[model samples]
Target: MRTKAKRAGIACAISILIAGAAIGAPRDVPTGDGMYANIKTTRGEITVRLEFQKTPMTVCNFVGLAEGTLAAAGGKPFYDGLAFHRVIADFMIQGGDPAGNGSGGPGYKFPDEFDPGLRHDGPGVLSMANAGPGTNGSQFFITHKATPWLDDKHTVFGRVVQGQEVVDAVKQGDKIEKITIVREGAAAKAFKADQASFDAYLKDSGGAAAAKAKARKDADLATIAAKYPQALKTASGMRYLILKKGTGAKPVAGKTVSVNYKGMFLSGETFDASDLHGGPIDFQAGAGRIIPGWEEAVLDMQVGEKRLVVLPPELAYGERGAGGVIPPNAFLVFEMELVKIK
Candidate 1:
């Protein structure tokens, strides 16, 4: 009886070992002829097959940011230590903000690039997240399931070719260890992911119209500036004319200030005004609650002072301008009055 019991115990142990081996079997890594992004995370590595050909600009932006080839990244990998700031089970995981919030971006915005053939049909779909049309930036999200409602709204640039499990396992605040670009085949190997490459792609892909629009905008700004030959210019490219001087103390950073303003385009057509919002709006100075132009101008003004400020695209909205009221790369003009400082 003791011998028989020993044999049965040995057999049970063998079965358990086989079961564990089956459970821990290695998953197959995907093989393809295109470029891939191996996004190494705390959970595991997720390999994504980038649709480089279909969405050239979007893929260029992603690859540039990942490899630190883009000038915007300042010669350092942008996503090495960023967190997956937004995560929802059975939905998607979003990240790539330096501020680790939904409100931040890469200090610039690009227009959307879309392909009708690409759709959010299943999980592991990688796409850009924007506030609206023409606001594509550094932030991206990977879907956990089919999010068809997002079709055409967000630019789908790639899909997870392997490690969907890792994507699903990610939680909010999970660190993205690094993203390595892998090129397969001659075509993928020859593709250059850099600012120059992106510029060339833009030129080839209907950038002439955009260039023309920018030239017109620049000429309009020059005309506006020529009219104000005495307008004070700042190192940061802001032009202002002090219309009225005040006797009250000047506002400083962290101080609450009330300001009435009329925002207009280069043509002097008003797009926004304080009267529309009931009265002068109150906000903390230098807190970034308002545009950079307003922040810079207010710091130099005393209570009851009024100024006519001209803001370049960099100081105002950059590429992604304010809603429909403002166009991309628009130069904004504001007649601002500093009412009271608290």
Candidate 2:
């Protein structure tokens, strides 16, 4: 819990935050509040808006990062001159690494506040991009289209208030021209509407909540794996592990399962990642685009499940290796979570 002074410092950075850990609920709802916006790097100009009422802390933290107030609070800026890093064909543009290299962070990590109510149904929504749940810090992304896969897992704090065109023009390696943080709480009318929807989800399927949570955990793992493949690891003395069960719905092939995951190497070196963007990552089952190891495990996942996947070099980057982050012919480990399937 945040102390009274820490809560106040959230707005002013004058108070100390001793242990503002993740206030776990379900695999839904974003942690933090207030609203914020990003000036962003675009071909021309674009401004994104954040809905603070729904995620006050997330928004407030964003604002603090933008205003250089985080530095005052013993934290460094995570967004300073960061790249839009990764850009999918028509999805979103990602950035916000203090290291400027993909391996950097905000000098601190924070827990996730998942409400399972907010969704990634469409474009303009801004969600916290992290290595995993409770690992969110200062990274964020802006969606270019309606990516329902992002619903209920990532911390979504704002939306593109206007200037989505700017997002349309962003390309890989594009520099963030500038990001202007703004405060615009959720519309009074929309607040009630969103809240009602949240309540409805809670009331309608009380029994399925556990199932949904498992699905979300699985989805989250998938998200982390896609982006940080190097993070995958195998048990000592074991060459690899197979997914081995459950394939009723082919998550890789359709909207059945959308996940957020992190990947690592045996040495714990991070190789790749996907959460830096938004949802665990939306893809079809058996899509040949990813590494073979992923192809084998994901097809077996159900919604809301989190699992660890370890692969031998034969199934991973092979001999050439992924180059930079991953070494030549190495074992890998992945912590995957399937957040949703719809």
Candidate 3:
């Protein structure tokens, strides 16, 4: 009789494990008290509570988009029919572009609203995706895991209260049927009334500023290419001059690499140096954490290799440029020495 009871208990435990695997564990509400947005997707629904007190501007902009009161994608609901264009497992899911591509936006841009109290502490974080500082638009992303690296870099507007199971199940090409604000915040209503004036302002200055920046970048790239005639060029337009040939393992994706690097502009002014930090900076190759040019440049290198890499504006910071340090369309030069690949 004892043996039969023990077997039944083991069978029950196995069934519970199977059930748990099918449905993910529950996630806590975004905040103790706040506004929430219910996002319906093909997989399921996700609820995110907006941090109105912390990031009022960001929350208001998101609310206007969700409610279809503010102009977006021809003044219609922008998120509907849009797919989660970029999905990196254990990282985040990105969408909110009407074009389903990273380049599209609401035909207008807004400045970033920064808040020190908010952060990317765990999964289900809702933050605005921008080209750089003060370039917030319609694109936003939701984290599926802890991403402290994104803190202070992007605006954190909301957190997921329910449907994290849906978030975890979301994959690339999954569609966000629509997103609706569950409880309208006061901030959203105020921004709704100011939408017209804001639109007019962006229309007058945004495009003109962008055009000027592009022209400047083009000139910079031409100057950089002429100065580094001996550097080998890749099809992606990245140029590099090998300073030292390495005999160790060739770097590939998913490998953690340690390297010492000095970043500078064409004028020879140094912006950042890892040697001063006492040791090499370690990061995962091709993780999208670093600039695209640096990633491509390091992939061709082996441990103990040293190279001078020149990156075009598009590959480095592009038209948006880095905050204060790197200008728009400015070509960047990096002196990199790969210490090891772990």
Candidate 4:
């Protein structure tokens, strides 16, 4: 969780690691033409326009989960009685978690589909909520207002065509009665919300390419490990090299600390730096305000120490990498110098 000290503006670039694969391109449909979901919740119905042309696989997954066509749903409507579970007053209302707590899904996950044309520019935008990149399950959220910071980090697969008031009125613990898919026109009508259809869609949209990318990334990580044979390995799969040792006090859980860091990929391409954000960034240790990798590494460092830390995807952003900078399942390398502990 890198702090957003500097906004990237409208160019929140995202790089999908599936090289040369035109993922999410609609197969026999025109853009702007897709199915709708009539979500009947405890409050009221929120009609969402599914972006099938832009994010076909995500739309398929949502439709399949709603209609019980995907095997993960056990052949029953999955959202029939699920709670909204989480809500933030000025941010968004999240739901579709079967566990009613935010950790449950339909027993499977899928890759993310991001369309540059779609954005969280205002209220009523519908997006997937996941633990990380490519971990999209059945959980979703609707914006209560513009959420520009989320752009490129989450998949924007739908938008509310009607029921803004209902979306705003939704509260935590509100149950969704059922979600009915409404198909219109030839393109939307021809689509099938079944597991096979989704599989075909995934195949057509660079599933093989994704596999190749994973192989390349794995090989690169192995090479890095071999190169840094003496690097310290943490219990959580992180590796680091202490470049400079400091004799100052180590930061604790409640202490606020500041650091200057340069973030890069395994290829040595810099993605972000503290200087880009004006100066050193600060956060309280162990507060969950930053990524697990940063939290763990910083806590082990002294005030004036510097380290070259390598974070695996699970400890960084998981399958969902950060905006156009970090790719999915990427290995993040950071040169961090702890500046102060306040």
lDDT of 3 at 187: 50
Give residue 15's lDDT in candidate 3 (0 to 100).
94
lDDT of 1 by residue, 1-342 (tens): 889999999999999987644433334446668899989887778889999989988899999999999998999999899999999999999999989989988887777776899999999999999998678889999999999988867899999988888888888999988899989889889989999998787666567547766788779767876878898899998999999997899988999999999999888799999999999999999999989999999999988899999998989987667665687678889999999998
lDDT of 4 by residue, 235-300 (tens): 999999999998899999989999999998877888899999999998999999999999999999
lDDT at residue 199 of model 1 (Cα atoms): 79
Q: Write the per-residue lDDT of candidate 3 for residues 1-342, one digit (tens) a residue.
A: 989999999999999987764444433335444577878887777889888667666776777676676756446666788999989998999998878879988877786665777888998999999888678898999999889877766889888878888889998999988777654545534444136644554564457557756777677777776888788889988889999998898889989999999999998899989978987999999999999998998888988899999988778997667765676567889999999999
Number of the predicted model whose lDDT against the real structure is largest: 1
Candidates 1 and 4 compared by lDDT, better number: 1
In the order shown, the candidates' Cα RMSDs to the true structure are 9.9, 21.5, 13.2, 15.8
Predicted candidate 2 versus true structure: per-residue lDDT over 1-342, tens digit per residue: 469767776856422222221111111222234343546453544555565555655655676666555553244443556787878767887777655556666666654455555777677777888764456666778888888765645787767655566677678887765565544334522332232343343344444545765575466457545655554354332233333333445464644456667788655767667666765786665757777776666766666556677766666776445634565445677777666666
Could you tell me every candidate's TM-score relative to the true structure?
0.56, 0.43, 0.52, 0.60
Candidate 2 ranges with C-alpha deviation above 4 Å:
1-42, 72-80, 184-342
Candidate closer to the true structure by lDDT (higher is better), 1 or 2:
1
Off by over 4 Å in 1: 1-29, 204-342
Task: Give, for candidate 2, the lowest lDDT window spanning 10 residues.
Answer: 20-29
Clashing pairs in 1: none
Q: Sort by lDDT, best first: what order?
A: 1, 4, 3, 2
Q: How does residue 174 of candidate 1 score in lDDT?
A: 92
Error of 4 at 272 (Å): 7.4
Q: Given candidate 3, what's the lDDT at residue 76?
A: 69
